[model samples]
Target: MFTIAVDFDGTIAYHDWGKTPQFVPGALETLTLWNQQPNIQLVLNTMRSGKYLEEAIWFLETHGIKFVGYNQNPTQQKWTSSPKVYANLYIDDASLGCPVTKPDIFTPGGRPYVDWAKVDQLVSEMVLFVEPIHQD
Candidate 1:
């Protein structure tokens, strides 16, 4: 199985971010499919906290995307005490190495965001994806 960390703002929704979040095309549908994959675990990793966090969470619920954990790996503590969340992949608009496009590429009002089409293709290529559990 693969553990994936996903951001809430521009990755899932549009650049509206803190205010009314507008979803990027195919974001919700892709997440919903990932959630149902038994060999994958989705973790909600984001900078959101307080009220802003609540709004993001609510948005996900309305879209039916379930996550295994939020901001932490539910099963990683058994192997490490580190606070950093361990994930096989991280889907975030602001991720340093992720492919992105300027606001101009998106619809007139769109802002810089992860190119989810590429993301979806990459995620699908790992058909045999798995992670070995380390033991002390």
Candidate 2:
């Protein structure tokens, strides 16, 4: 099983985060599907703190997303946070110059703001095609 570290602001929801963050279309559905899978776990890894993270959790729950965990505090230099064992994957839009270095990280853009369906489709397609590189 693997924990998917998904960003809250831009990945799960749109970049325009507010008191009530609007989820990107299909994001909830994707998370819900991932949650039901026995070999996959969803983790809310975001910069949001305190009540904000709680609110995000509530929102996810409202949309029937049962995540394995949430991380409001991430290591400063290291992008990931302190958590228990095992491998993980991250889904975020702020990954600057990613796929260029790690070509599998960046996904193809769909129809800008109105095409998360295509974006999600592209991500799944990329994941299927990209060979997993083991890190020791």
Candidate 3:
């Protein structure tokens, strides 16, 4: 089985910085197709919180996305939401911060960084589906 952690904002939706969010072209359709597969699970990872997050959930549900979980804080316990499904891909558009790695730049303290580019690349290459094994 393949689990995917897809970011809601810029990744599947067009994020205009301070402007209202918009779904990227083909995002919902792509998601709908992905959901039909038995082994693919789509999870939402975003920064939105509280009521805003609920609103997002409603939106997804309305669009026929029935199997999705939101992790507002990707680095915390929320990661436990879907512990059984090990994610092979995580898609987001921050270009700076990603949960899988250190921040891209040092905080005045000078530590390693999270390279969002690397995360994007890794997710892009992940295989979302595999052929089922057939018994002889």
Q: Tell me the TM-score of each prediction against the true structure.
A: 0.83, 0.63, 0.58
Error of 2 at 40 (Å): 0.5
Candidate 1 clashes between residue pairs 3 or more apart in a chain or in different chains: 14-22
Give the residue spans of candidate 2 off by over 4 A.
72-87, 97-119, 122-136
Candidate 2: residue 120 Cα off by (Å):
3.9
Ranking by lDDT: 1, 2, 3
Q: Write the per-residue lDDT of candidate 3 for residues 86-130, one digit (tens) a residue.
A: 455666555445533332342222223233344434444455353
- Estimate, for each residue in 62-115, the C-alpha lDDT of model 2 and write its tens digit: 878886667732222265554632235666656552221111223223212323
* Candidates 2 and 3, the one with greater lDDT: 2
- Give lDDT tens digits, candidate 1, residues 62-125: 8788887777898998999988889989888887887676776545346677777677777776
Candidate 1 overall Cα lDDT vs. reference? 0.76
Leading candidate by lDDT? 1
Rate residue 107 of model 1 by lDDT.
52
Q: Which stretches of model 3 miss by more than 4 angstroms?
A: 16-21, 72-86, 95-125, 128-136
Clashing pairs in 2: none
Candidate 3 lDDT score relative to the true structure: 0.56
Q: What is the lDDT of residue 30 in candidate 2?
A: 67
